[model samples]
Target chain A: MDAAFSEALIALLPNLRRFALSLTRRPDQADDLVQITVERAIAGAGSYDPDQRFEPWLFRIMRNAFIDQTRRRKTAGTQVDIHEMPEALPTDPGPGLEARLMLDSVRVAMAELPEGQREILHLVCVEEMSYAETARVLEIPVGTVMSRLSRARLALSEKLGIE
Target chain B: MQIDDETLMALADGELDPARADELRRLVARDPALQARLHRFEETRRLLAGLRLAPEGEDPLAAMIRGAVTPEAPALPPPANLNRPPWVALAASLAVAVLGLGWWQWSGRAPDGFAPAELAALDGLPSGEVRRLESGEELAMIASFRDGDGALCREYETSGGDLVRVVLACRDDGAWQQRFAAVTKADGGEYRPASGEGSIDEALAAIGAQGPLSLEEEEAVLRK
Candidate 1:
């Protein structure tokens, strides 16, 4: 692997892990998504345009991996049991407990959202992607991205009990 | 323009054009209720931003990477095709088991060993002594002191950079003991201990500004 590619991969790990966790709502699965994305990116390093923003390309790969997994699960007739998910770390006496509880509520709220809304929310809010970039990733118009984001935000605000 | 949800989101995200943003700003300034509503919406976004995405116990990315990197092992030879006898296979299995056990034993993941340098650096300082290390790093050494709960409390920073407030009390045998420990991030990012806080002349002033320290508590921690 090229040195630049390796450096980029390491730097992206934290954000990629965060994005994956948002999608899967489970640390292990999120890590799996990130790992798969990295492996695929590494394997197809030649296909990547060095001039472009590496994040969007990498996100596309992660989204594909997630879609593939979802399809596989659907075919296998097996559902992911949220309760069986592994813990992220040891429970420390700090903001960790409160953070975890809030995260649980957020995950539940996210799951209740429509798939399109969820994807757009992840891309825009979590990933901090622009509407144009989100449009490109979702292959939809920028108007659609804005609409989805507005709906997602309203739904999330209601779910989280924000006035 | 009557600022709707889309416009509010755009303004919050800084996606609005400068002229439109200025207009919205003027509107918000004129209307307190609109400003309050905008503030609540912004707060909701901030709260969501702070939410943890990863649950406890799992690292999905690590697992995924491990799965990708771990090459599939070559298929084992069929039992019928193997020329080795049952005794030979059993011996091989035992050898493999022994190797695995030895590897586990040699792994240095145990928490028993403390870094000698760090421990030594801590040792020279007196109880309640706030010393700046050679690297200009300052640390507070608090001794177990009696609190309202009648417990001895020794507060210190954990190795992980967390400020731990502990409550300790003297037991029946006269040994100062820890009652409870609460880990919290230091406010205002102030990790450096205040100077002149440990001296006898400044002890009263220090206690007034900071807090008290126990003599035995200092000795007990130094022994660690």
Candidate 2:
């Protein structure tokens, strides 16, 4: 059963990384965040409720781990890394150069957005999670999820020059 | 009828009810403004989809997280307090949870086959111990007990911090032979494994116990 659960977590790596990237705004930091989240997950596994969906449980762990990492960095006063504010776009090849440019535009715009809004957008729009699921992941009210995501989408659209 | 941002966002994210969705579809068809608004959301979703961090192919990130660490984050730090490496700290912690779990096991009235002094020592043992492995895994022993057949068994747990698992492993030869395992229940902070206890009881019933092992017999069984 643990093996099955671990396999389930493996299946969620992409989604987890996507959320981590959205929160951290850099590939390396996102990877680090995922690693920390997994470490905390393993350490805290004894507390997991098997009856519930694994994704939200995991998202909660990742969110908390990200929070912990942020807190620690804040305490350490560590210098921010360059990759954190990455200007490089994601590697997915869009349909055309124009499409690629637009994707880059969205990526930059997404980076510019606050972490809270970006996280909601990734959960709702990119990962296709509903408002309730996104809310549960972020531990916010469903209405807050909707409002935040609406504002994020509007922001992304305006920044991308979408009509 | 006017649509709020929440409803509009829900409709755009495909979260609206079918009746409402169909009505919205009809509304959009008749209203180019609504259609364009929906299209904008869809187009943004599309553009974002193209920015997926993990591209098509085998998901290397899972394997990476399972195996090695990227340069950004060190795989794991050495356990605090002890100068020894992480695995050694884990071994120590396991001994600690085992004792706690050992206490939890003996605290039960059933024929667990552990002595009172041994059970009482659990209180002396520390709590909230975290055992880690060389492979970047963690262990949390929920409880452990011997079956009726006198097989020294342990009902411990394993976690990668993302998922917790409760396992029943009976001593066979020299190593723990796993008999049962399942995801740990995170019922708030304090968790009681109902199924895990059921498995331990089931193992005793299936194997047919000779009642609780005496002190000498338990020592002999555990030594193996």
Candidate 3:
């Protein structure tokens, strides 16, 4: 691998970890997923198209790795519960305690969403991925991305009582 | 005209065409129910954006991957001047610059301290707004607050190349003085939730900062 590719992969570690956390929910599993994703990315770096954006390509790799891991875990009869207690949520004192609590609720509500909706919401709202990019990442139609993201937002709003 | 949820969501996310977005904006402005729906999308996005993941230290696997990628070197020395708390290093440089010290060779920094573009951002960029420079660097104003001395101060974040820096600058004697800064690796396009602790919290505590100013309050301060 070239220097640029290695550097980019290293820089994207935090993003990979966050996405993995969203997928696996457990921090330990999230770390393992990130490791697996980086290993796969490096192994397949030669196939990555230089002209395309790096993020969607990397994210696709992560999601695929997650699916593979889930299948293996299912066969072993050791599936991790999706509702595993969350680690202590981050508290941002800068935004004040009230806003911080509201954000905590947002995280809790997000966890309750359907897996498809949760992933799309994280991609669009938190990661700020464009609809086209999100579609590429999720392997879905752009229309599906829009409708899913819209539904996710509405679900979140209703959960939070934001009329 | 009835607007679909997808269209309203797209408008809220800034994914719609400019002309169509403008049209919807006008229509939504006239309808209270539409405004509420728009607010739902907007507020959800805002709250979600606030769900910034705190950075745990780099995993050991990263080192393993680094080793695999590098053919010649087993390990590279960590980037220089970053092992220590960045604000401590930045504070020294800021002190030097403030005392009319000789020019120091900090990359992307103006000789007088603030980059011309950064000064422009400090002057007017509202909290939560982001500006992209011609050089592909992105500047985001995080918030504004009053320091212990009641000076108006702003906290902003800048990312370019592979590094993101969060800085606090205060208005002093008709100029913005660089106060505190912390650096971290850029995680592609992820929304960086300013971590609660570490150097930023230390800076805030040392400065006796009250809290972030509201939009109206920040605007009032900027107007002066």
Could you say which candidate leads in lDDT? 3
TM-score of model 2 (CA atoms): 0.58
Please list the residue runs of candidate 2 whose C-alpha ends up more than 4 Å from where it truly belongs after superposition.
A46-51, A78-89, A93-95, B53-224
lDDT of 1: 0.53
A99 Cα displacement, candidate 3 (Å):
2.7
- Lowest-sum lDDT 10-residue window in model 3 chain B: B94-103
DockQ of 2: 0.33
lDDT of 2 by residue, B1-76 (tens): 7866667667777888999988878887888878778877787777776766555665654553343221232355
Of the true interface contacts, each candidate retains a share of 0.16, 0.39, 0.57
**Candidate 3, CAPRI quality class derived from DockQ:** incorrect
Ranking by DockQ: 2, 3, 1
On DockQ, the stronger of 2 and 3 is 2
Task: Give the Cα error of residue A141 in candidate 1, in Å.
Answer: 1.6
Docking class for model 1 is incorrect
TM-score, candidate 3, chain B alone: 0.50
- In model 1 chain B, where is the ten-residue run with the lowest total lDDT? B95-104
Query: Model 3 segments beyond 4 Å from truth?
Result: A78-84, A88-95, B54-59, B72-224
Give the distance in Å from residue A128's predicted Cα in candidate 1 to where it truly belongs.
2.1
Clashes of each: 19, 13, 0
